[model samples]
Target: MAAYLKARIDLGTLEAGNKLPPTAALMKQFDLSDNAVYRGIALLKAEGYVHSQQGKGVFVSDRRRLIAGANRIKGITSPGESIHHKLSARVEAPDWVAADLGEGECVNRVRTVNRGDFILQASQSWVHLDVAEVVPEVDEPQACDPTWQAIYEQRSGNPVGVASKTVDARITSAADREALGLDADFAVLVMRSVYVTGDKVIGVGEGVYAPGHPLAIA
Candidate 1:
């Protein structure tokens, strides 16, 4: 179905910047099952051929997918996409976070990447007290902007010195599934990162990306 649609798009049968046929319509026309139709559409999206806009349906796109490296994973946003973040206000640090950054009250950050109403990726991170002290932006109560590493450098004048990332596939947690709007407990690509600046370990974060997501590599 993806190949067929690509061919149609190539031939101008499905013009660029036009909405694709509705899922039901595509299912009928291609004689494919519902899952098959969605899978085909997902493939098109991963390849930068299309994007889903929640209630607006899928549309053909001529833009390239945003490419990110391991360091830029949490900041990946395609052209014209929106990002929503939630920052917990002065919460007790989680045990695991304390294990890494010592015992103290810390802030939790959840960043959701969206296109129209469709969610693309979800990243949840905890801020260390030192980082929060250096960068007050982390302490904002209603932070809705997905943050990149450079924010720290720009705000604190401390460059990101060394970084480490652990990438794996894991069963989706209930929280992540809800955030990503998945109907089932599918496996997701996960990346946990730690950033060190000078002699201080500034921050650590985890990013949850959909399998085969175009920007998942970062």
Candidate 2:
């Protein structure tokens, strides 16, 4: 039932901000009791498909429209976004980080991004030692205002040309669930990003986002 409703939203039959039929009408159409109808809506809500208002009923969420589809991701921070949490330091590269950036010490920046009060996703980035050395602020993180991508381009005499991204769907880790404030285990979208400037790759990043969260490829 939830999938049926989601299909409608995705196909634009329901459209964003469209109010759902009354609960009883939905129950009747689906041949479900009140509890079953509610359960369906609850599932949809978890997937960022719809939202309930105090007295206005359920409606499609605009967030789903701006989101990335097929699990593809981009770390383009929109205006008004902020860093919910961040930790930056120099550390030995993890195996995955080494695979992308090489087997050496790198500046690790771990951060959780927020849109308004909503937690968006958590990402861990590994930067080439040279970039961090030249841009000392790279080791001391700040707001998500200027994306790490933007920082990598600023005053380095080279402009970022392309960003490559790959994504995988996997089980959410306990630590990440805590970071995203999830109360239960759910599958998450794991995204890997490599940023390139001139002919050199400057950094690699991995981000974890909750299910139903909108994908950003901007």
All candidates: CA RMSD (Å): 13.1, 12.1
lDDT of 1 by residue, 95-115 (tens): 766666567777777778777
lDDT of each: 0.67, 0.72
Clashing pairs in 2: 67-215, 68-215
Clashing pairs in model 1, backbone N/Cα/C closer than 3 A:
none
Give the alpha carbon lDDT tens digit for every residue of 87-142 in model 2: 88899998877876788899888888787767778878888898875577777865
lDDT accuracy of residue 73 in candidate 1: 35
By summed lDDT, which 10 consecutive residues of candidate 1 come out lowest? 63-72
